[model samples]
Target: MGTSFEKVHDYMGRRVRGLWQRNGKFYQQLLVEQPDGQVAPRRILLKSTTLDNCRIEMAQKRGIRDQGEAASEPLEIPSFAVCCRRYFDFHESLKHGLKRQTTIDRERWSLNRWQVHFGHLRVNQVTRVMINGFMQKRLRGGRNPRTVNIDLINLRQVLKYARDCGFFTDQERLPTEGVKPLRYKAPVRPLLKDEQFGLLCEKADSSANRSGPILADFIRFLGFSGGRYKESLRLKWKDVSFELRQVTFGSDGLSKNGKARVVDFNPALEAHLRIMHARRAPDCKYLFPSPQRGGKDIPASDLRGSLFAARAEADLEWVGFHDLRHFFASYCVMSGIDFKTIAEWLGHESGTALIDKVYGHLAADHKRRMAQKVSFSLAQQAASPAEQPAVAAVQQSPSAVLPLPTQSGESAATTALAS
Candidate 1:
């Protein structure tokens, strides 16, 4: 058959005239009549070869045109404030199971600052330049790089959620991806000295404050176990195995890494835990019961206040509760325990890189003691010069020594020896 042409009609009965195939190639043409009644033809080369394929292509084009027309009309996009609310709602939904209340609270706090600045704008209108401006404003307001980076991270999450929900067009880039976080150096928070720890504990025990003894025990427990503040505070009675000398950090996202970990108890921690366990009330489920809140886990705020008072009284104002954990890790490293072991004990899922970065510095006394252990010299010999091999060789060989080739292809014996 000669190259055939056909008219294709869409569902609306609008016919696309110039649907034809020649030499195994299909073509589509649209003829529009102008206001003056002159016809202008617009041609599109369709890659299909058969008449059926041409008809299908024509239908697809019509559907795409309809979609384009619909897209051209205005559609309401939610504002940044609305997206923030939705993000917070999503986070709140995940609370009590996948996420902790404290985590959600922090996210909300970080995103609130964003809402204050970008709330009026739609999610798609928050561009990278705007984010960069926000970062600059934060930095100008005396916020640290780490804090600003956290804010950016929170904003990024909200925007991503909006994009995924189809509030933003696919072509829009996330501001978070375009903005780079500022680089910052972590401050050095060293471990407390033995005498300092002793003084703090002594002061804590002697203080008239009701939380004094609790603070002392908590400090010592942290020093012994190297556990995080929340990890130790949330330690349940059932999670501790006194007979096995092991404590498990588990209670649905209790651990910082969101995975359960077992920490072996040393004799010190074991003895202290036993004492606490024995004194614990029958109705109390927490290992460290709150003195103020009866039966509940001790609030961190209480411990923090107690810790501050104890530190002041003991003249260890620089020592924080986290220092106790650092003290534990420092001792472990000085005792020749490998970083991998320390990381595992600290409930780190990743290996020793973090441990090495934070706890790599050894105390001066420990360094000096280590230095004394390294010796290069051997014991002095009682042999006389005549008994020494070098002396005997020089006396016996005098001028009859064989030349040994040197690395430079020269005779070693030819070079004069320094006296």
Candidate 2:
């Protein structure tokens, strides 16, 4: 806030500051003499937010450390290192199980990489330009857009945490806003109709012969339910309610977002599941347990292997299991189901963006069909009321309107029967 270094020097003329080093990093805490003659430890620790501003303030005042740790010695500016340990501790405490361990690990890795890049510099010395420079360096180093975005996200989160904890006086001191990262296109690979049938037939027949009906039923289950790969893999016996004809997955199981939803079962899947229940071991917890490893979780690799073998046997191309879910969604759309319904079935987070990205084509087709229906309805309304009755009567009695077939299997008279 001082216009000149003399002003800041005169203001902090008599003050006591504490200094210490930990984890090869030095930190300083200082008490300033206020205008009212009151002394207070208004800590100005350096970090990504205040790094540059703090340096400017220090240089302006020529702030110095007392040599003898007492009032008798002249002051000298002390070099303080940014405490990454402190930053990480604070981050971990704030996160506190809100995020997964893998996520926390990623954040830590991002922070560490940034620290290694500029760790020796005081936290208060960080500036928008320096931050931008770091980003440019990362991009030049061949980091992908998504990776760069994640790093920025992690950094922003840490900076926000620091601000909330009063580490930085100015919350908006860091330039975290308006930094846009590139987005890549989503890869969609829906299974073809023939591929779907072949996968089913191959899985069913192979597993049936190998005493692995559970594996066969599981493949069929995914196709019918359109559940996510993890959701299908982690399904337990209790999750499937036979009487309700639905499989419910919630937080206790593999529902990642801790959301509970039910997937309705078709007749084919229901019959298959009924047979499975009868043959399943009474003590088995999982609906599809590992055949060789008792009491252990089903192996994702084994399922992939089975799928690969089936694909090869059926002479079908390799496709991810997720494609089956997409195929199911496409089928639903083609069968006249609405986007909202499809979204619910797939457990997708609702919004226009997801619909635009995932089912945009289906939505456009739906709109076209709706427009045609509206045009037809308007035309029918403009016609005579008697014509509407005749149309309704014909629809109501197809047998009465259709001509009977003769013994020779030809129509007797191309004429209508009694109406």
lDDT of 1 by residue, 1-419 (tens): 36555555556767646675455566676553322336666455675766567778766665554565443212335678877877777767863555566777898889889888888887788888888888899999999999999998888888888877777667867777858889988887656889988899899999898988878888888898888887788877888887788988755466776888778887888888888887877877776667787545444345898989989988778888778888998998888788898888887676798887776766445676676555423321343433344334554554446457578874433342222
Mark the 10 consecutive residues where model 1 has the least summed lDDT: 376-385
All models, RMSD in angstroms = 13.9, 12.4
lDDT of 1: 0.74
Clashes of each: 0, 14
Runs of candidate 1 exceeding 4 Å displacement: 1-75, 95-97, 278-283, 293-301, 363-368, 374-419
Candidate 1 global TM-score: 0.69
Q: lDDT by residue for model 2 over 65-154, one digit each (tens)?
A: 333233222122111123445555555687434655556677788878777766566454556676778888888999887787788787
TM per candidate comes to 0.69, 0.60
CA lDDT, every model vs. true structure: 0.74, 0.60
